[model samples]
Structure formats: C-alpha cells, structure tokens
Target: MKPNLIAARKPEEAATTHPTILRTVLEYLLDKGVQPFVGDSPAFSNFKRVVKVTRVEEVCEELKVPLTPLDDPIEVNGEIFRKIKISRKVLEADKVVNLPKFKTHSQMVMTLGVKNTFGCVTGLEKSSWHMRAKNYDDFANLLIDIHRIVSPILTVLDGIEGMEGNGPTNGRKKNFGIIAVSRNAFALDDAICSFLGIDHLVYTVKNARRRMVTPEYEVFGSFSSTIQLPSTVSTFERFSRAFSRFFVKYPSIDKRRCIKCRLCEERCPASAIDISKQEIDYQKCIRCYVCHEVCPQNAIKLVRKLI
Candidate 1:
C-alpha cells in the first residue's frame, strides 16, 4: 500500500511550499482514481473563516482537488448531534486524507491528526459539543467517536511550524521542520507525541489508546525527520487531576495579553467566562478549553484551581 505522507513546514513558508504539498497529496490519490478532499475545523469558530485564513481554497484550486464544506448533521452513538456533520464528498470518496496542523491544545494538550477531524463537525456544532461532552473523559469519548466514524484513510501532520504554550490558536509559533504521515490516525498521532517527547499517557493520544487506538498499528514510511520542540508543559488533564481542582485547568484571561475583545466569552459554550471583569467562573466551567483554543491574543492560560 502506498503510504500517506505528512509534511511539515513553517506557516511563513506557505507561499513557497503549499502548492507542492497540495500537488503531492492530490496527484498521489487522484492517480489511483481516489477522490481527495481536504478540510479542517479551525479554532476560529467557522470553517469558511479557517479556509480563508489558511488559503486552503487556493491550494485546492491549484491542485484541482474539490473543496467541500460539511454542513449537515449526522447521528452517532445514539446521540442526536445536530452539529456532527461530515463532508459528503469525503464520505463518498474511496480514500480520505487528513491534513492537520500540529499545535498545543488547552483541553487535549495537543491537536494533531486525530483531533483535526473535529472540523468535520459543522458551524456552531463544534461549540455545542463542549457543552455536551462537559468533562475531559466524556469529551475524549466524543472525539474518539468522531474518529471512528470519519476514519481517515491517511493522516498528515503539519508540524513544520506549530503552536506551543497555549495553542491551536493564540500561542507562540515554533519551528519543528518535519513532515509525518501514516495510514492509521492513532499511529500517526502516537509518533508525533513521541517526537515531541511528550508522555502519551498525558495526552488524548493516551485516551485513544484506552479506546484501543495504538502506535503499534501499521505505518507506511518513517518520519522524514524529528524536530525539537520547546520545553514541555503539563497537559491540562494532568494539571486538573493532580491539582484536585474542579476547575479543570480551563483558560483564564491573561490580563497582560487580553485586549478585552470579549471574543473568548462570546464563543464560550458554558458561558463560564466573565469578560467584564475578565474572570472565569470555575463552578459553571466545563473544561472545554474553547476560550483558550479560540482566543486571538493567546491570552488564556489553563490554570488549575477549585471553585
């Protein structure tokens, strides 16, 4: 089987390299008559906005691959998930390739191959999921369920330059110039966790393992190279558990970085955030980390505390 390849590059180098990335993936799949579709649910609240910000449409056009926007909901696991939708084009395609950006996640620690599929859920549905899942374990289950259904034939990580500290958005960018790919999402993510020197047990990747997703799964080619990431930080899950906090290490407004934009509060699903005083109500908090994930200023930090 031809292995799916994930390449890494700096976001600043996008103009020079995105076309190559697009062409390589599209042609490889298209040559086998396997339809290729690229999609991601960015932290920015809307899929279209993500596309615009990433210029994915231009990349699709350049590669002649079709661009699909998933907007209809589908039921999974007896849950009436109105936001759980997938691209029809991807669903119908013989092969699905996932292109995910590598970055730190306030809730999950890092958003890599497996977490990228959250984009398949449509519009406000992504935010609603935070409320539905409520806690770390339940939310991890939801993510696993989505992965079970979407089941990308291949996953590629965009780790050339990824976010760290507080990420998925609103964090510092670091250069980890390596590309990785694999047939199995679990294996792909496992490799990334290893490369980053993070304990798989501390990440959702470990949660994936409890759900039986493992690194032992078959892999295609070896990673092109391993890039060094910055110094490590505690995963929110670990911080929450160790600190004995009901707050679950949710993002708190960094008054130094916050511009008082209210974006985090507006987008928060639990409405646990108070923008007026820039305070978070830990009692009402759900630990979704959406505020941290979506903050424009990277002003949110996952701090542990009890209500």
Candidate 2:
C-alpha cells in the first residue's frame, strides 16, 4: 500500500500557499508510484465552483495530476445519494490522501481532517443531509457513515494557517504554524484537539471517540514546539441566548456584520431561521450550525446565555 500524504497550509501566506501545499502532496505520492487525484465536497455550493475559486485545477495542471470530479451517484443503504461520488482515480489508486485546512466551525467546533471529507458528498445533496440529520449527534453519525465509505488512507491537516471564530468558511484566519499527519483520522483529530487545547467533546470528535476511531496510529513529521490550541468554548458560550431550546449552540447574527443577505435562512435545514425577524426559533432549530458555516460575511457568532 502506498503511504497517504497529508499536507498543512501555512498561515499568513498569500493564496499562493495552495500550490505549494499541492506540490508537497503530489511529490509524496509520485515518489511512491501512486496516481493522485484532487477534489473536495464543499457545503451548499458546487465542487466545480470551489475548485475554480480556489484555483485547485490550475495547481493540478501544473503538477501534471488529473483533476477528477466526482459525478456518479451511488446508493449506499438506500440513502439515494445523488452524485454521492469521490475521485475514481483516488479510489482505484493504492491510497487516498487528504489535504484539509484547519479551522474552527460555528457548528462541529473545529473543521479538521474528518469534517473536511464532507466535501466528498457532492452538491445540494450535502444540504439534504443537514436536513436528514437534524441534530448534532445524528449529523455526526451521518458524517461517520460517510467517512466509513470514503475512508481516506491518510489525512494531513493544513494548520499552518487556520480559520477561527466561525469557519469551514467565514472566519478570520489564525496562524497555527503546524503540519500534522496520521493514518487514523480519529487519533489525528484527538492530537489536534490536544495541541489546540480545545475540548474533545465537540460533537464530531466525541462521536468519533464513541465509534473508537481515534488516532492510535503512528505519526510522522515535526512541530514547531507544541501548538497552543485556543481554549475550548462550550456550545452554550457560542450560541445565541435567544435560541436555548436546541441544546446546541446556534449562531446569532452579528448586526454589524450581517448584511441581511438571507443566505443562512436559505441554507438552514430545520426551517428554524426567520430572516424577516432575524430571529431563530429554537424549538424548530436543529443546531446544525450550517447557518454559521455558510455565512460569507462572517456575520454569525455563537453566544452563551444563562439558563
């Protein structure tokens, strides 16, 4: 089996950092005679659009690797996942390596190696999962199921420069200056949470733990001293005070940052969001945090409230 290579993105570099990361990933694979393919399943948007925006195609061309799009739909357990696809080249290759950005999510707490795979699920179908999984634990299990199917041979996190505040997209970038890799996605995430000093109880990691999928695997690479992760902020602290019933932190619209674009309302699966009033109905909200994740303006924040 070819070793999977995961690379980290350094913080503070211009967008040019992607190509450098891509080169490192390709080099590692080429050295082992593994054919490489690159792709991701971004939420609420088309993969082609994200690749174009991120210039991933250009990087693939320069590296002489194939830029494969996941276009075929596969039904796994009657899920009817349309275009529920992955890079065929990658699946057929000796190994599938992942390159994920490091970042904190308004929902899921931190979007690291595992959460990054959500991009593999394909377009609009991704949002329907949000609707189907409705609550945090269910969503997390769904994520695990997806991970089981797409099973990356190895994962590398680009923590050199990562997002914080509210992310996956829509957050300020922070410099973590670390590159981490592991064959065990769970262990890698546990190590990352430890490095960041954040709580592992965050939904995704917690679910991974329950499933016993942690990073008990060996690690390779170096760190610039131990990375100081931000302290764990509880869901209560980050959620809006108004929507307390959901039991998970839901983002509050930052009046100053909010352009009232209604993107959050449109993407919300629970139909809990009321853009007209700019209020979320907690009873209806599932606390998926898709509202916070998809906001382009960084207009949403999680706030804690006294019960």
Candidate 3:
C-alpha cells in the first residue's frame, strides 16, 4: 500500500490503533465467547514482514490473538462489481469489526471506516480497482460497493492520534484525542467528517447521503480544531468555479528523488508507470495516488494536469 515516513512516532502515533485499545477490544470479544482474529492485508505483498516491523505481530502475540494474513482471495459479486476479489477469511467471518484510522487521503479526501475496508480487496486486487475507477467519484463508489458486500457489524475509528494534510500514509500526526464507535460505518464516517470541518459533499459522504445508507446516530464528543486538507484539495479550493472546473491533478515521479526501487511501478494497477524512464502514462493512470503512497523515497508528487 504505502510506507510511513514519521520516524519519531511508534505504530500507534503513526495513525494506527493503540495497543491498549486493541487489547480492550480483543478482551471484550474473548469474554463474550467471540473468537477474534487479528488480521489484514498490509499495503505491500510482504504482509507478514511489514506487520512485524509495524509491531502488529508483536501486539497480537502479546494479546495472545492469532494474526491472520489476508492473502487468500474470494471472488464475489456486488451491485457495482462483477468479480471483485476479496479476502476469503473476511467473507467467512460471522461478524467483522472495522478498525479505521482517521486520516486525510490524497484520493478520497479522507480515509474513514469505508475506505479502510478496502484492505479486504487483497494486495494487488486493491490496485486493480483503481484501474477501473480512475477518479474520486467512481473510486468512492467502488469502495462503497465493497463495503456493502463486507458489511461490518461494528466500526471503531482510531482517531486518538490522526493524520492530516497528505495522508493515509505520508502526513503529519495530530492529537485528535478521540475514539468513535458505531454499528453503521457510514454514519460514523459522516460524523467524523462533520467534526473535522470537512465538507459533507466529499465523494463518500455524498454517496452515502444520496443512498440513505447512513443510519441515525448521535455524536457524544466535540472538537473545535479544523483539519489541514491535502495540498491538492486546498489548492483546488482557492480556485474560482470557472478555473476549478477544468483542472485535474496527476502524480509525477521526482526523478531527482526517486531511487529506482520501482515499488510504485509494481503496485500500479493500470501498469501506467515506467520505472526505467521514470515516466507515468497519464492516459492509463487511475489517479489513485498509489504511486505517491508507495514511493519509499518520497519522490512521487501530485501535479495539476494541464488541459
């Protein structure tokens, strides 16, 4: 998926669920006779090794919970999808508890409950969806479709330490000091967006509201701080309606900064990236920001597409 740049923060500080919170949830599930399996497909193919470095393996071991890697894919049909591959274990589970980290996403505007479930799409299949849905609107719809298929029973947002600006992976950490839980992830996500002063018209929010998928819910906590949106979004906001109507932003590889690792090229869903020439085929590019997210050297940058 992507690499985290903040070296000062531990796994929790880097917008992941705190070990204490995870332990509490697991304990509650165990007490209720629900066997909980700590599992997810990490952004990269080497899910096992990455989890260890991120301390997920350690945390699961300390809590005596089995860690399962979501590598096995199960093709399932949805309203908007024909043969999307999702994790088999996720499909087999009686109930799913979503643990989403509150963060600003370059593509989705923000990554909340619904966006987090995209991990169920398996490693490369997650990228392939980007190929199909090239823009925010279609991508958001794709995410909603997958979420509908998974239908997690509960969603717990890790907002205690959240990320703002360019995020989901690379961004500055903010002490949001909040945790939200709900049976309806869409409602919880909407509440979070409202709290952060982000526009409800964001693709996910708009779609959820349009479909009436968001359930009735009440927010118990309040925060007054405004979040810093990604540069691409904030830049678009500064433009007048006329100028903004035509501009598009696409990722560019900083030739000077790239180390030729080809991580972005490999993860690219549409196969538009060429590491040898360090060029991205904009025609085939999906604007998913996977290139920017996976660039280990911080080489990929989002630039406005010239019309």
Per-residue CA lDDT of model 1 for 116-206, tens digit only, reads 7766665567788888877666776677677767887777666666666655455566776766777787788887776556644335677
**Deviation from native of the Cα of residue 42 in model 1, angstroms:** 3.7
What lDDT score is found at residue 10 in candidate 1?
Answer: 29
Model number with the top TM-score:
3
Which 10 consecutive residues of model 3 have the lowest summed lDDT?
1-10
Candidate 3 per-residue lDDT, tens place, 178-217, comes to 8888888898888888876675546798787777777788
TM-score of each: 0.78, 0.76, 0.90
Those runs of model 2 whose alpha carbons end farther than 4 Å from true positions after fitting are 1-17, 78-94, 218-232, 235-248, 254-261, 274-279, 305-307
lDDT of 2 by residue, 1-307 (tens): 1111111212242211355566787877778887776655455455555555566656677778776555444555413223344434334555567677777665566767776666565555677787776666777777766666678877877777766665555556667777787776667877777555554446678887887766465546544433322222454434553443434445688878788888889888777788778888877766677787677676777665443
Per-candidate clashes come to 4, 14, 2
lDDT values, one for every candidate: 0.61, 0.61, 0.75
Model 3 TM-score, 2 decimals: 0.90
